[model samples]
Target: MNDSARAKPLPTPETQHYWDGAAAGELRLQRCQACSKAYFPPRPFCPACGSRGVRVFAASGKATLYSYIINHRAAPGFTAPYAIAVVQLAEGPRLMTNIIDCPQTPEALVLDMALEVAFQKLDDTITLPVFRPAGA
Candidate 1:
């Protein structure tokens, strides 16, 4: 498996904006106008209030590692070991992403570690938002 196969993204009508933002080297999140709550996995309406007044905005690309699990088994196109993490963005949304550019070991994946976004372009249309140790 190649990077292209591993880089496939799930895009829905509601998430097209997010994928577009990633393509442009930007991180975007959806905010509800009614409740002013920022959320991830962009949806058609606000999850908190069920309002359709959701807007997309760019994020600061700063986050902290909330939790993670190290996978030693290699999946198709994935390396033998990698860290799949849930990162808490500075904007208050938690996103499920992969942590990159560091040793994928329990000793290196410290909880609450600060991280920054690093875009990995898989192909012409897809880009992945991976995180690395902040300032590394």
Candidate 2:
């Protein structure tokens, strides 16, 4: 595909740090200092208590399959039969990401399966967070 046809990333001030971390192969998240809660989709304030003193931390990139669906219909920039998954990270956040490094069939995906983070760089400024089966 040409550069113009490739997918573009949407980065806002609140999400810039997270995208930057992904470019460096790190999973970054927002943690509420007061409640000790970790969350994804970086925000300006803590969702638990509306506190603005949240901190950014690098995650271990370990997660478990929370839920998912096998999409058979093709979209503008995606192929058919891809797995769209919601992964529950070990740090206490659920991230929406794609399941890669395996077949997109029902037999290949199981609930609560262990997964590890992987990245797909689409452009100079965007890196997508994907997941794969975890090792022992």
Candidate 3:
């Protein structure tokens, strides 16, 4: 799908830093200072420990394919035959994202494949962090 056709994310105050980091070509995630666990879908408090002492940091941007499904039906802003994927980050957080730079096929989208972060700019304000096969 074209970049303009993709739905833009509405950044909330709590999630503004995440969007900012994406625009700056960084994959930022939250880490709990209290429990030393990294997480996503940004929040002020740690889900692991319920501590507000969470800190935002740039992630390693390395991940492994955890799970995915190839959606062949066309939808708003998304073309058919795209893989909706869950990738486990090196820091231990798994997030839902799209896989790009490769064929969206069952054979191509292997389980446990190594991936790295790639930014797709939807506009001036939003740059999404998608993933692609590592070294591809």
**What C-alpha lDDT values do all the predictions have?**
0.89, 0.89, 0.93
Q: What is the lDDT of candidate 3?
A: 0.93
* lDDT for each residue of candidate 1 in 1-136, tens digit (9 for 90 to 100): 4564564877888789898999999999989999999998889899999999989999999999999888888787788778889999999999988888889899999999999998988778888888999999
| Residue-by-residue lDDT tens digits, candidate 3, 73-114 | 987788897899999999999998999999999999999999
lDDT for model 2 = 0.89
The window of 10 residues in a row where model 1 has the poorest summed lDDT is 1-10
**Which candidate order results from sorting by lDDT in descending order?**
3, 1, 2
Ranked candidates, highest TM-score first: 3, 1, 2
Error of 2 at 80 (Å): 0.9
Candidate 2 lDDT by residue in tens digits, 38-126: 88779989988988889999999999999999988766567788888999999989989998888888898998999999999988889
lDDT (Cα, 0-100) at 102 in candidate 1:
86
Candidate 3's error at 126, in angstroms? 0.8
* C-alpha TM-score for every candidate: 0.93, 0.93, 0.95
Indicate whether candidate 2 or candidate 3 has the larger TM-score: 3
The best candidate by lDDT is: 3
